[model samples]
Target: MSSVRRLRPVWADATPDPAGRPVQLSLDELGTPLAEVTFVVVDLETTGGTPAECAITEIGAVKVRGGEVLGEFQTLVDPGGPVPAFIQVLTGITTTMLIGAPPIEEVLPSFLEFSRGTVLVAHNAPFDVGFLKAAAARTGHAWPGNKVVDTVRLARRVVTRDEAPNHKLSTLANLFHATVTPNHRALSDARATVDVLHALLSRLAPLGITHLEDLATATDPVPEDVRRKRTLADGLPDGPGVYLFRGPGDEVLYVGTSTTSLRQRVRSYFTSAEKRGRMIEMVRVAQRVDPIPCATPLEARVRELRLIAAHSPRYNRRSRFPERMPWVRLTSEPYPRLSVVREVKAGDGATYIGPFSSAATAQLAVEALHETFPIRQCTRKLPLVAAPGASACVLVEMGKCGAPCTGHQGPGAYAEVVDRVRHAMVADAAPVVEAHADRIAWLVAQERFEEAATVRDRLGGFLRGASRAQRFAPLATCAELVAARRSDDGGWELVLVRFGRLAGTARVDRRTDPRPAIATLQSTGEQVEPGVAPATAAHPEETDLILAWLGKPGVRLVAVDVPWACPVRSAEGLGDPATAVAALVRPRLAPDDGAPVVRLPGAGTERELDIAEARPVTLELDDARVIPFSIRPPRTA
Candidate 1:
């Protein structure tokens, strides 16, 4: 659509307004009062649909502040080409009538001057802005990064589709009773857009969106109840902290933490942009927000974890199932075995390995331990006396087990192996590493290269599991530990930890002496017994949380009441387990010497086979025991 009736006489000379003022509001000033914002509603009548092929026929703009027009600018430009007959008929801008109009080079600079220092507005803004930006680029003028607002988006949020059949400029102008009708003219459309912007702003006022950022993001589909409940965030603290949304009955509807202001983060939920239906429902029932001020972001994170654990808030999905976290435990019996348990029971004498995120990981750790040592795998309680005439299990016949249940291995000897398992769990893993190396070497010597690689990977997995266990072991055994990090505001954020649990946290003001605050925190922090079972521990989840926090950069160890060290020969000395495992498993060729190592039908006896190239072999022993094997070639120099 176009206008063909533009016939205004051209001015003699271009008189550009004084250069546009720079936008006063910094990007961070998103919360700036809307009433004081300068908005420039702009419209362009173009020769065609896209900027690449189109030239501006006319430019029109109205600058307003506080709903009052401050100025108006309008000008027609020469396209330097013939206006199509259809476009001339549609817009009333005849080619003959535009004979001496000023070109875009003159019209663009004045328009830019008029729009300076204002947030640009238009119905479906990109079309108008795109043309202006293109013109500025072609004219060797810098395209100022002006903040833009699209009335179409604003209308979508304010006026429902039911209120207006569509968001077209004419439809919205008619619905809002705009002062100037949109009749395919640049000036008239720009004026209509100005009115629509005001109408949308009025709708936003009741929704508590008085800030520029709020209006920009207001098109998000927010529920009516959520919009009304925005008052809950009005008085919230603007600082790093944990916030809880509580229902009328005071039950926590949701819990979260923010490194920035709690008020800003909580207020974000009230806007139409919050699309999570669950969050919207929570906000509807949320009657108040409770902010727990934290001195540091880390402290807020810790508190959020603990609160979510304690309250099991319906909206909080993570850390709520602390009880479901798996722990790798050594059974408390004459023959100890690694097992995954959900609860860490007191007085069980079982060494607990973790509150692993999942049972699969805990099982992996257990499997690693079994691969590294001859720990008992049986669940049955054994007597000092062996049952007479009992048949041995397959593991016993295959030499995988010493058969402690049948007294093939003495209790004293088995206890020594159990002691090594315990040592590997917390201190030294040298015995497991040495044993794995020896086994890998033996397999390689026997021409079982694939089995050797498998052994190496198993050992790597065990070492990694052991390394992680050792890292947490010291913290779990400590009576108390204090750690600190520099806060964003140049203050110290201190945390008091006991038995691997976050006992208390405090943020010291930059101007205040930290010693007093530290002392107060130390006195008030919960005391926990070192090595207590998780069921009886102050906070089982805190150990993992603290471990993760310590892993982050810039955290400093402030103080410790107990010995804080790991064994010098611990598994952590093992390099990246995955890299090590991959190196060991990589396929390599072995020298061939013709020999019948293992018989396979349809394959010649002269075919030399490396262990990696061997097929699976199952042997049925005389005692009815099955042993699986990978057929290997004879070793050759």
Candidate 2:
């Protein structure tokens, strides 16, 4: 079928270029009087549900500025097909009525011209906007990207469900005593929607939503009580900082940091657009906003982590349970055993591996290590003299332990095994990884597929945990480090890191030299001893926080007091474990020339699989005998 011909406008056009015209006002100018803003409320009656299968039967719209109607546009369009019986009965538009009407090709261009330079409003807007975009595409016209607001969503925020049974246009119209009643005809519905729009906007005025941009996010869930606290942000300085919301009892409710203006970020919580229910509740209960200004964004982030750790705020989820975080440590005994601990004690003489997210992950890493080396897994205090009646554990009988508790294994032999475990946890994980690879291969060959997969996942998890521990270990050992990043405003953000904690931070303006500021901060910073307990030094969470910031774009390592490096070769070479596992479990597809295909569970249709381009296979572990070794580029400073 030939495409429909494009039609040029016959009327004199005075519309400006939508792209060149400025729509967003500056934050300072956002208080522009709402009466000057224009709105175009639109409604459409369609033949079906979605744009692809539907055609618009009629269009109706009204333009208003500041609550007063300026103009109206209405039209009937011929869909060029028989109207469905149900649609005709619902819309009262039959094939006979549309016989003499103009086609959509003529109706759409005029409607676009009428609605130009105005924010479009509709009840559940996506349906009308989708149909308009589809009609424009079919008729060879570019769909103008216009700002839109949904009245249904707005009504839900302004009028509570208890006040109005539902947010339907008719229900809202009756509840608000609208000027026009909705009867489902295009014009009546559009007019009713306009009334609903005004009612919602009137309610929004008290909530400090006067700007056009504010209308778009008005449906966000801010409680009525929280809206009154908008003045809490009145005198906050516009800079990078951490903000704490305090409850009535002076307890911290939530903690957050912003690189932009602290005033702007905290003020957003009082608006209807803040939709996180937990945050909304936190804001509602908050009696004051406490702003802790920082010299740089990095400092703000570090302070936020420290504050969250200190207060363990009810609304702060992460970095709040540092005491509960698991640490993988070797016990201090004649025959040391690996154990997951909640705290690292002073003078334990034990080599520590992690402050892992959970005990389960730390235990998994320990189990993977035990599988490779015959280490003592029993918990006992073995002395130079053995107990008279002590017997070996079952693990020792099964050849999994060295029986060090019963003195069957000498200190020299057990010491060698302990050294191997320490090396695997600290420097190299190759031995454990190779052992797991061999076991997985043997299981696969014996047709024990499930067991093989389980062992493979365990090995992956251990490698990931070990690699992470190694990356952060240097921070704990370093005496001092200095890092810098170029801020968006052309300033240098200098970070003074002592051991693993952020000691100090300062922002050096581009107009001035940064050397003096950096030197001053570094000289006055706190001294941190290597391998100190977290209670005495900076929390482990601070190290992770700094590492994450250093990984972001525009950050650079300017200087370091000591050298640091990640391993050049290790299990990290296998790449991300999740990605590797996904490749193994993903269903394979047969050749596409109408061959019968067996559908695997969770796999897409055969056509979808056929259309997908083949990805180059990397580190595939299908052959159990092949061990993948990764040579990573060493990161040094």
Candidate 3:
């Protein structure tokens, strides 16, 4: 592509590019002076503070520009209901006073028109604006998306406790010596608030806040030294990407991603829109920003996770230590037992199940498996055949384990039990679901609803973990998978995913052919070898992110080497155990090209499945000398 057609970041300034495209600049790039800005001080009286539950009874506003009052708008509204006694006493506006007033439907149009294209000002902005917004919604009127400022917030920043005891409109009115005294009526309070706004602006004037943008952030708790760091936001790409905030000596202080303009999002940290104390502190020590531009928002988010994990910046709390996420591993030893581990080795030869949400949830899933199949509860490394003098544990007495240590079960017999769990981890969870179904239904029939619900949750966790593992395994070993999605800008966002990792990405302009872009992507994309199954070459969380992107609406699969297939019958959606058992054994639709076959344990039938779509797959569990550990089915129907 020529330079004129090359993709440019959205935040590039309006200076015409080689293509002569006329680009418009964002507000922060070209600021408006406060003297030229219109501010409307508004106040409202309502039945209550809850906007959703309350009704607006009155509205008052004064429009000013350059400290000169241009106009005043006032209206009394019939709220369509009686005013509460407490509210009537508080504002001195009764139901009788509102009887002949125009309804909010009549008043909203005039008020919206009067406040159009101006910065809204109020005592407590959310309280006043919230009422108007709620009224607009209730009356089906379009509310203007205007800038808002609260005089109370402004006073807190500009006026100290030495100037006033509290930052209230009434208290500030007394301090500022307003021309009009606030008597709790709408117009009177609005006029007083206008005076307070002017007084606060006068105090800020000495600090050189003469622009609307400066006024917008003047009330933020950010210190002046930190505010001076706003220049760090300049020169970042104007499109979706990850941004790193660097402290002195170039240590990364924070990692963030923006699907919108990187400059715009980075600039927000220096303004009032960013209110987190930790972030404000991060911005304080930050000296510069580094941009990592991406072709798609999904790639940006995935890279954000990877960077957070790689850097483990002190400021980023989550995704900093994904390695700490626990996984339930069915150990590969002779007497295999399920174990919760924080790490996975590629050649361990052990079957793995999850990087579960939490260690607790992973343990619950293990217990669910143990409850259904007597895999083993012992952590001891038992020999293939038990020694003559080896002893068994209490669980063996409880029939929860086939004690391989004492030769009660041989490796062949033990493997049968372990195989059932292995199946649940990677293939089919039908056995686990079927195992829990009868006990759960029996408990429900016995009026033990809580017990049944516990089993249900445990079963759900195991199913989710297993299904997640199954879903991630296919893409893990796939050498390459190229896909594309439509971008919001009428362009195409192309991605090169390798072993579940984002190897390369490109965003094409809508007017350009995406074929050349895709060709460039596949040739220049990072080269990655397939990693172990389940996790593949990328982190499970990262794979989850990629899968999410692939699964989004309008994602087109350009090419792939691996056949994407999962079990058509998942471990969910059955009303009862019998139904689940029946659902598990039913023959699934199979691809004509010879997919894998699953032999249902005890069902005495083999079923083939279609792997074209990679749905959920299941397996049957076989336990020798099975003793009922579950609540035995009740005698009742």
Candidate 4:
């Protein structure tokens, strides 16, 4: 939890050079290298004076290939203690800003990943590159294999500058007319440096900067500190496997694989920060890093999944485990068969069709199937039934079934009917619904109103049932659903439901890490992070509210949906809806207020009613009477 500056190791620990001074490159060093070699421009913002005395505060890099900017990478590191006062003010970084940033050990892995396979570029190459080399040495990383490009020296060569007072980044920015925003902030300063380089390159292309080889040897000035740390990375072994860079909070800064030379590959982030989105994010989060060397690429690939699944780190994209199959159980006695729920199970051979994420979904699917075919819901055919002679059940009495429990139908006929029902439920609904619609149309055309009504009811039921059933299967794994009802106060009441359980109930998706989420719910970043907030009584209040209404006792998972006007408020204003509802629930005289108000159905002693649940509650103003509200337990519940 140290600030970004505290995350960095002492200069002697992570880099060879104690002092981060500037260096220059000219066309002469380049000799005859190609026009397009992968290049990475790097920069470091650090506590001042010397590398040995100070620490790196930030690392920023921009990668270029064939003169095109690829991407950017950067991270703030704690410097192992309080940042120098001047440093904090200049960088707009404070102790509070670094509270959650990781340390040097955690950042290295991500840095290494970003640095892989590119020539290092920097405006004053030696100054920035030297510190990077020093840091790498502390971590036992080799100097990068890539060569360097110093725009400082290149600019000197191109500009014939007798008039220049200094060879600073600002002077260069001014010379080229490139807009420079901030000077001390690593990322911003590095960007301005890149712009300066681009301008210098444009002017110097005719002066030998056009060719990569020609630009290498061009030197303007050199810092003694950079010269000492110039030894390329050494003793690196090529191996395949996952590597981790540990930081503060035991944070995993980066995860990566390598076929060879782990040190060389990981050291490049210091030399190059710009690469890809993943690499950049990794760099920003890294602290201290380490590698789990693997014997082969295949082994590395395998271990990657295992480790990723186990840790559930912030940067990984894919899941570690394959999805699971879901199934449903029917308790009736025909030896109690398990149905493979297609959406839940797909082809996974799950014996039951419904471990649906929710009871509501399961009911809908079963109902849809029942409507499509003459399947009896009698307990007699289910394994869950108490006895073979169990009564016909409510489904039969409702005329939803053909009464197959008694002598009305034989086992063979009934089993066939069940199979048909299962098929319709499992298969696409388009053909089945269309066929049923046709039957209803034919019956109505023939003036068979009774038959048409039956068909009409069944068809309507099928659509509704199917729509509801589909909500659970193949459900959004981490998202929750929100239901909103309008209140008379021109406001809306919200209901949040846990959809993840449905996915799990169906056993379609499962998490290897069972930790409740935390970071995502509190994120103020551009995008929401994954996982749920840690289970806290205060969190997920909406889910708890719904469960309370259901008379179901347990901690609830909450999801919120609110109107744009109330962006941050939860559904019901975190259970304060009663106050607002009082305005809408009043006995109303307005003609428009007469619109049907479907209050949740509920019944209990009058004393049990909350202001939110009160029926016929009178508003003090105008003696307004609120519509009666009701609550009903789900039929299956």
lDDT of 3 by residue, 242-265 (tens): 999998989988999998778767
On TM-score, the leading prediction is: 1
Please provide, for model 4 over 152-236, each residue's C-alpha lDDT reduced to its tens digit, 9 standing for 90 to 100. 7776765666646667777777766655554777766766776666666556443333445334543423222322122221223
1-637 per-residue lDDT for model 1 (tens digits) = 2222211111111122245322212112234556568888898888888899988888888887655577788878898898888878777777886789999898887788777878999888999999999999999999988999988888777788789899999998888777778887788888888777776776776776666767766776666666767778766777889999999899998999898788788878887667788888788788899999886676788789889988989987786876787777877787777888887777889877666667766776676677667677777787776788755677765555678888888888888878878888767766565555445534644656566556555665566556656666677677778887776678887888887778888887788777788788889888766655333244555566677777677888878976777778776665543333222332344424432344222212122223445433221111222222223332221
Q: TM-scores for all candidates?
A: 0.70, 0.66, 0.65, 0.30
Root-mean-square deviation of every model? 10.5, 10.3, 12.9, 24.5
Better of 1 and 4 by TM-score: 1
Give the TM-score ranking, best first: 1, 2, 3, 4
Each model's total of backbone clashes: 12, 1, 12, 95
Residue 53 displacement (Å), model 1: 1.5
| Poorest lDDT segment (10 consecutive residues) of candidate 4 | 500-509
Error of 1 at 112 (Å): 8.4
Model 2, 243-309: lDDT tens per residue?
9999999999899999877877887887765778899888778888899999887788878998998
Lowest summed lDDT across 10 adjacent residues in model 3 is found at 1-10
Off by over 4 Å in 3: 1-141, 150-217, 220-237, 267-277, 332-335, 357-360, 381-386, 389-391, 410-412, 437-461, 571-637
The residue-level lDDT of candidate 2 at 534 comes to 29
